[model samples]
Target: MTTLKEPVLTKRIPTHPWGDPTDRKVVSYKQYVKTDGYKGLKNALAMEPSDVVDLVKAAEVRGRGGAGFPAGMKWSFLPPEDGGRRYLAINSDESEPGTFKDRLLIDFDPHIIIEGIAICMHACRLDTAYFYIRGEYHHQREVFEAAIKEAYENKIFGKGSKLGQINGRDPDLFLHRGAGAYVCGEETALLESLEGKRGWPRIKPPFPAVAGAFGRPTIINNVETLAICTPILERGEDGPKWFQSMGTQRPEGAPPHVPASFGPKLFGVSGHVNRPGVYEEELGITLKDLIEGLCQGMLNGKKYKSAIPGGISTGVLGPDEYDVRLDFDITKYDTLGLGTAGVIVMDEDTCMVGVARNIAHFFGHESCGQCTPCREGTNWMSKMLSRIEAGDGTTRDLDLLLEIAGSMGALPSGRGATICGLADGANWAVRTIVNKFWDEFEAKVSKQRFVSLSVVGS
Candidate 1:
């Protein structure tokens, strides 16, 4: 089994295979400082902020928030510090089902992320940061809040802090609870929710880097994304090269600018795996190795049926695709981009139609109803799946399911822009399931009273 030379982000937090699970516990501020926790921040303080940004860019730290965008480039996107109150929005609203990696960090190693937040704010000159955690994280809210208090106590923020003033303001971080809407997980929608408005996506080009969070320059990053900055900076000059050495290298002939899936990622494996839990592994680890090695094979020795490469949003990997690598390049297998890397494994006894049905229903309910294609398309897919799962579907229902999913206005070929990625996720998810399990869906539909039906005029 492949393993990192040693744990980086999961160093303090115990994860499977690498460390004994029973040894896990919350690391307090005192414990954190003693273990060289804030050393990364100290390293940053000794260097110019632009140099830090350049260092992270050199490391090619990809956003661990599923999108996998480079953190350094994102930091550079900010308009020059004009003595304005630039903002940082840490997306801790990890509401996506099967995605629990962020929660694990908040539950135990909150200080690492706190340190990361400080480094990012310092580097980007973002004076204020809002940690937008999902409301469902009731206990986690308290845990993280207490951690932030620890940082304040240690002068991580507030007046007289180690960071001092940047862009005419003392660096500060605040915790903002979400209203438990899934759509608010989107960057623009989260910004809107933070503004005390409905959680709906905003039009882009004013992309958060330019104007966000109360209409100022803003930067949004996921919890894991920010947490990783700690290690990169801690290593100082050697950090970037050290990071690139672990994960799969750039494709043989790919351009230098094309981002490689570098660094370790926290994959929350759930569903039918025997050892269903989060594990930290370098990018490009094969799904087969993950399931067989870290996950300890399927539960009860059942065969693997399917698995979601990341969250339900990224779509499923068929049994034949077990060897597919888990990384940003996962889309080459036809699923959506590797999302949060929150994998959901299904066993042989599991029903594929029901899987698609549950996923469609979730998206349908969670959709904010702002975009017509996503709203109508997702709801239709849900109803059709329910019918198919119940054996009340016709041959035409299967075709229409694919058609509606494909036409969901998520991309250029569809109706129009989906505002946020809800439609894209929903479409790719259902479409991948149907395409991969065509035989299963067809058999279920064949049991119906009608084999074929003409479209009814609307």
Candidate 2:
């Protein structure tokens, strides 16, 4: 077992990690305009489009989304030759459980995202874009829509607007809200939802870049992925450089600022802690720092036994892995992908079986039902977990789940982009839970059976 030094608690959160003042008296409309918020867009106008791409690549400002694909690489995927109307879709559907960081960006700093997306569209030569928000965030939707209107009224985004005047060209950006569906958080599923479809994922090889919404080349980026553009362009290569300056300098420990493969992950800490909010720290911060120091430890000095680090899909971590740094390379230390970067902590009272079952149930509902493997696999995993929690599970059932999950794991892909990562994510969660907490689950079943016999005798 890896022993970690105790954590240090702090009151202040880093500015980039959703640290904006929420309870303010001033109108957000006036506040953003006064702050010179659109300065990045102004700077983007002076440079050539490809120069924007080169600047992002040079600064190494990778995506904040779970996949951590390079932002520059994704932009470069836009057609070199003007094939047709390319689209940029902002993935604001924050449905991933525990991942609440993006909600803060939309609720507090909507204009910043707007400016970032506009600049991104300019760089990609995209004429139209969409801010695909989750439907349940009605208040966030209202705030975001109002900000979009404010930007247009101030001539920041529409054709012949101040943004156009600065960029020397005009483009269109629109806001569209999605009915709450966790599957829609997937890029391809999001594209399906945007096109007035039922939101089922499509197979890959013909990635969205090749055949996307309305059969046009498209780019689906996360909300934070777009927000980083503000600093990227504002500093004009210096912006992202300043961001890269913060956090640990080690290449091995998590991907510092931006790894060659993965980027800085925006993680949020919640559950049984003093400061139960969010932070945009580097990928390498210890889990102990995240839950104990940053989140203020378990509430009322309670003992924390485990935590679901990363979205519901990343699997749970016990005290043994507490010292492990938060990063994309979660594959090390028995962790899966650090998805969506939402850390849900569990105190000593939390039931490991119940937690795993709850997560399995969540995926069961969110499966897009397009591919048979995901459609059937998620349901089977959910049922297996339910049976185990209810004491109806056998040793064979546990083995059965691993088999199903193994079959559902990413196939040896000849093509790159698959429908969505939903199936693979579901498999990871089930496999991690079953592998790590097998003894706990088996013990639960035994205890429940004994209680049943005792009740019958009584």
Candidate 3:
């Protein structure tokens, strides 16, 4: 339960601008307003909706959700407002393993997210926005509910409120509690769940921008993505420029001025780190710098063995890969994936085979069972890994595990077999562990066989 220390970067941009990180008390609306909290909303309300989108796009703010999709570009995809109702769904289902930044934001700086929602509602011309929060996060839900009530009381969302009204209509915000399903973190599944249906992902081609949430056009964004709107609008063009200035420059052979990643990123660092908590740092900070410099090296002075640079879904990076820049562009590195910036570090004594098995078990149990490749594949991989970890697996089991995982199309190039990213996470967990630690897995099997023979002879 170690608290995350302040970020180590000297030239860091402002994060948690409204609330003091050390103060556990939630920042009140009065305090929030004191720090220019609703300025972004005011600015966004003044401009044409398209201009708001262009401003955010120029800032290069990518989705904080693991996908790294550009926020402005995503908003731009919404169909014209032909007098039809549009909705903005905030994906507050912070259920990803090793990821907790969204919950932190809700707990500490709820008003910021509320303001961001208001700004997005203005920019998108949506009268209603839904906060689909995880059920397990009851505390955060209460915080958000209180914040929304405060906003309403202060005329932030009802009639006659400058921030809440667009074209004389009062905008509305609702909070929906999820049933603690991990798959609901997926946008379409979340939308389905929000519509009071089973949380199964729908096929594409009628993307959410076209048909979403009761057949109305929708713009679904992660909590962090929406929260960033405040700063983006506050700074105007400078906002995007400031965000772009921090991350690594776009690599060669890419569109001009395309940042590799942009803006300050909140990283949830856990598992064997000295401070197992969320640390905000600029994007493109090297894993080595985060581990050795910010995290103060591995806990108890242990040597770093491996780490999941992003969330567990991103796959593991071996000790040698520590130098890889922690940005969306990490995909350029072979066998690496950039998920939600949840970093789970492992020390030298940790067992890769066991780690893979546990992760596989999580996905297996969490799979919605709608898709066979994922439903069956995740469970099968879990069982194989468990047997191997329990010293009861054969060499062929290892090969079969890889074969099944590969066939699931969990790898980056191997998508399209499942309805969502859950299976890909399961696949990457097993694939990367076996790929990087084949020797360990093989030795586990060999040792188990040796022990069986010895016991039989004895």
Candidate 4:
């Protein structure tokens, strides 16, 4: 597929292959305007709210938060204009490991995100907004808070705002800092946290769109997901077609229900890469080109062994899977999804068992303790992986790890599993690692640091 002609999202932020990151600095409201900020919101305001939603739907802007849900389709899900207190919660909870893509925008170009928030509020008629930021982002919270302050002063929000009262309420935004709980990164949990309750995923049927945030309609969007709306809105009517022009078309016979991975995406490269950082590129860029070209190849010239295509949750991309395209359709290769597009690259010497152990530990620790399978299964897998890593595990332990990883987070139809679907990151992360690196896992189980598998797919 053809690559992006120029950075759309990072145009002002100064990402690599285009501009120097060293020259980056926090953009003020004035600088943001000079750089063409808020224009999208202005355009959005001029159109009917439904028309604005239609434009985004036409563009098919998928969620950057991880789930690849189309933003406009999500907007359309709201149960009509009840003229009550609808809400918009901007998710800046960048808790996913290796995923610093959202942080990059919030750090430097806060207005772009702020403007996107405004446009979304106007489009969806969401009157009140909450920027549910990561509690650990102390500095980013300050920066974003200051930006919101500037927006208020400049009449971007508050009563008599440029967009006027939305849904019979003044358009307003607030920053709600999270308590650093990874579970809070889940949208419902974020809502619960925003509402001064424990951060735990709520069961569906009462999805946030219908009854979110204090029993009212709500829209939760990621910072990057909203940030991308700026460029699309700026381009006006050509936005959708412009967006569709860049990314790869969905593979033939693809599920009609599945959304297309059109438009550019921000890929955060971490781990053993020479130039590790966030780089905005077309959705279909190959993992090999991303590493060898933009990342400047593996660290210390060591050969690349594997990579987690989009955060640990999406699972590992084997050395042979380097040419795999980074897109929503990547699940065809057996990943959960193109999760947050945070790639964690691994070098040849890296221990697969150790990687799996660490991932299992993280997910096990982060489970909200609400789902029995997620709570227990992750811990069991973690303990098993640890035992195997400690060279005290037998072949039975290895088989058990696979079985637990496979069965974990499964619904009631398959016993011993319960998760919010959004909470199944660990299930995929640990399972994919052991499956792809079976030889390594089997070897480690044999008290060998690196041994070939004694049996295939055992």
- Locate the minimum summed-lDDT window of 10 residues in model 4: 410-419
lDDT of each: 0.89, 0.71, 0.80, 0.87
Ranking by TM-score: 1, 4, 3, 2
Candidate with maximal TM-score:
1
lDDT of 4 by residue, 387-429 (tens): 8889877777777776767776643322436647533677778
lDDT of 3 by residue, 1-458 (tens): 11223332111223332233455667778888887778778888888888888888888778998888888888999887777688989999888888988877888778888888888888888888899999999888898999999998987787666654554468888899999899999999999999999999888769999999999899999998888778778766577776666666777798875556877778888999786766677778888788776677789999889988777887888778878888888876544456789999999999999899889989899999899989998888888789899989877788788877776753454456887778887777788889888999998898644333332112
Model 2 is weakest, by summed lDDT over 10 consecutive residues, at 2-11
Candidate 2 lDDT for residue 301: 88
Top candidate (lDDT): 1
TM-score of each: 0.97, 0.87, 0.92, 0.95
Candidate 2 lDDT over 1-458, as tens digits, reads 11212110111222422334444222365776576667788889788888988877666655666776778778887666453677889999888888898887776678778888878887877767888999999998888888888877787677676545322346677888899888888788888899898888777768887777788888888888887777668777576566565443434554445454323445677777777776656666788877766565688888877777788777778667777777665656666666777888888787788887888788889887877777877887788788888888766666677777766644332022235677777777777777877888778666443333322112
Compared to the true structure, candidate 4 yields what TM-score?
Answer: 0.95
Instruction: List residue ranges in candidate 4 displaced over 4 A.
Output: 410-416, 447-458
lDDT of 3 at 249: 70
lDDT of 3: 0.80
For lDDT, candidate 1 versus 4, the one ahead is 1
Where does candidate 3 stray beyond 4 Å?
1-22, 163-168, 255-259, 410-412, 448-458
